[model samples]
Target chain A: MNTTVHEYRTGWKRALIETKISLTTPGDLMGFVMPTAIAIVVLLFMQGAEFEGAPVSLGAMNMPSLIGMNIVFGGITAMVGALAMDRTTGTLLRAKSMPGGMTGYLVGHLVSTAMFIAVTVIALLAVGLPLFDGLEFGTPDRWLMFLAVLVTGIVAALPIGAVLGALLDNPRNMGLVVFPIMGLVAVSGIFYPITALPGWLQAVGQVFPVYWMGLGMRHALLPDAAAAVEVGGSWRTATMFAVLALWAVASMALAPRLLRRMSRRESGSAVAARRADMQRDW
Target chain B: MGHPRPHDGPAIAVADLRMRYGDKDVLTGLDLEIEPGGVTALLGPNGAGKTTTIEILEGFRGRSGGRVSVLGVDPAHGDERWRARLGVVLQEWRDNGKWKVRDIVAHFAEYYKPYTDPWNADDLLDLVGLTAQGGQRVRTLSGGQRRRLDVALGIIGRPALLFLDEPTTGFDPHARREFHELIHRLTDLDGTTILLTTHDLDEAEKLAERILILAGGRIIADGSPDQLARAASTTAEVKWIQDGRLQIHATEDATDFVRKLLATDDGAVTDLEVHRASLEDAYLELVAQFEAGEAAAAVDTFQEATR
Candidate 1:
């Protein structure tokens, strides 16, 4: 008998590429891209509108709002949704059993989520450039600020996404997560200005990372005049980066422990029973 | 049977393995030994703890209590090297369903070191009779074809020990035959040790060198197919013709009886025949015995309590 020796060799790039290509599924394209597209177009029309007291051209606001939406709905939400679906389907357990599997697979997912967020950002930019006529996209330092916000937002949101995925164990529970976060998005100046809200509501909005991410992007995209009226000045941009970074660090630290705990509860029979039950019911 | 000396032998040795789910125990002090080479069929009905034992051996599930050694290492603490030595085809996989056939196969290739270059995933496609659909999405493939893909992925790593969980459950007759041939080729050519579980008795009879039947989380019987078929306690059903009319008999020694009957009757025996017992009959008989034993034990306990 040769009794061959075996070793686990994982190609990170290949894994990442495979993960990216899988994002073309219909549910993902429809659920993620459609809403962002609608938000952008609506903001474009709203930019040209004259409100009751003032003429508010929200066209410029579209970029920041879309960016904010991308962080919550696109980056974080999709990451959590994907992992949750994998757990529900037994894919995560199956992968974890393979050699060098979990690390390779998760690295792939992170890359894929980052790539998707980048693509969504580019698509939103392309749509924004053509839709609003008075919009003059500049070589403003705003791009740096937007990139900073996006990176921090995605990194921070990933741990929370992973924790939710680990804790929820199913996609429907993830839906519960989506509604509340969407509620946060609605109140957090993504659709309209949070500044227009009452004091208590504005305080509630500030507590969420989504609001800070949007505020940071707005400082980068909107002209100094509009940004000053909303968030004081460039000083708030640093604060946004620091706070979001802290959340990211905290969530990342907590994710693995939560994942391990959840894994402890998983058994082949129980999973099999759950799947059988799901098939019978659904 | 004499116990074989433990001389750094056997690819897998499991003893006193026990597992529980809530109040019900799935595996109750079960034991198993798998030697290297050929296939060992893990046979059991639903909820029989066949999956539990296999999962624990594969390091995918934790056993509540037991000592298990696979390839000289305890599976509970086995590392990536241990996992790489084995290939597992699970009951279901849905992650790569969205990927194209070629991409999915090629991508999995990177997960193993010293893996042979994908030798005609198309040729394999042809072997599994999936050539016409090689480029199609896996999700679009029929259940049998997808199962063939699962087999393909399992063997892609060229594992030393391959774990197959009902590999042909959804397969039609033709696909099942093809899959059997594929399995035979793997063992013959590469000398891969395969541990498989199946509800299909025919599959066990055709493929396995040794078979283990599990019931109520215990190994009720384990031997070669013929040895199990002729297990001392199990009866052999026999049938033969005595005159122009047909005659049927059930006995432990059909061959001996047939010879004696032929000698006494001279040329009276028209259709001298003896039907060979099958694994299915032996299996059903064993399960029945186990169930009856449990019932009797329960009644005995009741009687003792009343007295």
Candidate 2:
């Protein structure tokens, strides 16, 4: 097999094309913009509320938290949904038909998703830096730290999404993933500090990547003294990266086996049958 | 990049292919072979294992026991290099609905670039007669247009062999005719071999140089459409009024039978009718007899009629 770099280049090109189309399309543009718009509106509303005797307004704190949440939370749900939808629509089978198409598809999806997350986060920052008090990014260290957290958070989320996608055969059952994440968000403390929750709720939040992602973002962009209100009374940056790293490693290990199993079962007739079932479900 | 494809063997070769799902056998020791570069249609009623057989050939499904090869490599072990030499078009395709027609062609064209010289997107669109809809999103295309696009995508890589599974199942006559013309045009593309499966006997007769009728998990009939249609039965039944009484007889030649009947009746015969057994009637009757029981008898019946 004389597989070449051209296949990956093609995949990257697919991502670029797909991203451009989504940005231009009305329905897809809403998905990209609506969440960030809502986040900005919420930040404007909470600009005055102080959080647990911290110098930062609740809105300033919530900005980084929302960005973090979007990475880990939105990444998983969106990937799971995209995979299930693609299976029913025969896109997966179409990919399998080509020589290096599967690799191109996956590389395209991951890069495009990262591009979308970056765009949403940038939109949040564009509004956050000027409108909110107590948010910091002037120094080189802060910028590097923010970029690191964002990259680590994305690495932690993409494989988990791929695994969930392989497990859930029906997109309708996406509520299985959504409902649990909704419950997790309440405890992960996107709108406030996790230290304010019950000790047990704080521990539950810490167990998943969602809470750690929030903490990493806070460590990156929030004032260092703001960590006084956190669970350990400081930015536990090492533990946060360590935990997210473990999540990434574990999921990356499992994702390939499951995704391979899923791809093996894909065929033209199989896709047609699954699509027929999906229509009946509708 | 300079590797030359080996093209000396039959395009497809299969031996004793078997597929078993739990206790049920879908394919029982089936065998087949096709020399490269001609259209062959696989005709079978439902549940005759046509899908199973085709899927196995496409390397999309595994078989219980068999040796199968396409393009000189065993399909079970066919690699990307092997895959690049074949094309597949299925029954339905609504994927990539968000992409423009030309963009989809362009994107997939990229996938084949590392392996071979694929068709240019515009030229392929023109070949499939979809140049007018190149700018439109795929979801807006009508059903026939969509199938044409599927064909365009399938053969974009300039594959040596193309598998078309029931290409015109729900097509209206005009649409089917245009699709058939497009299929005919495809034959000029440097010895591209096509294997299509359908239940439409007329379509099989129209498009295929050879037809294989798969029934009872094996191909019982294989020949040109003319031969298969002629094999079913060769006699016509004649009915007439003779001396105010109805007379009926069966003969191989309807004209000769009618001539004899009228002459023997001495100018009293009237209201004559000749009912030759139709190709469709033979096919449907064969299916009906197979459904009635005695799997062995179905083939026996056709053979006896032919004899």
Candidate that scores best on DockQ: 2
Write out the backbone clash pairs for model 1.
A47-A57, A47-A58, A47-A59, A156-A248
Worst 10 residues of 2 chain B by lDDT: B298-307
Assess candidate 1 and give its lDDT.
0.69
- Fraction of true contacts retained by every candidate, in order, equals 0.45, 0.66
What shift in Å separates residue B27 of candidate 2 from its native position after superposition?
1.8
Candidate 2, what DockQ?
Answer: 0.60
B1-307 in candidate 1: lDDT tens per residue? 1111222577889999999979888888899999878999998765577788888888877888989998778987876656666778877666556778877676666555443333346565665566777778888987777877877777666666788888887678987887788788777745578999986667888999998877767776688877766553234555656656788787667768777877888687775566665556545554454456563343233222222
Top-lDDT candidate index: 2
Highest TM-score among the candidates is held by which one? Answer: 2
Which residue pairs clash in candidate 2?
A: none
Docking quality tier of model 2: medium
Q: Per-residue lDDT of B160-247 in model 2, one digit per residue for the tens? A: 8999988998899999999999999998777899999987788888999999888777877888887877765588888888778888
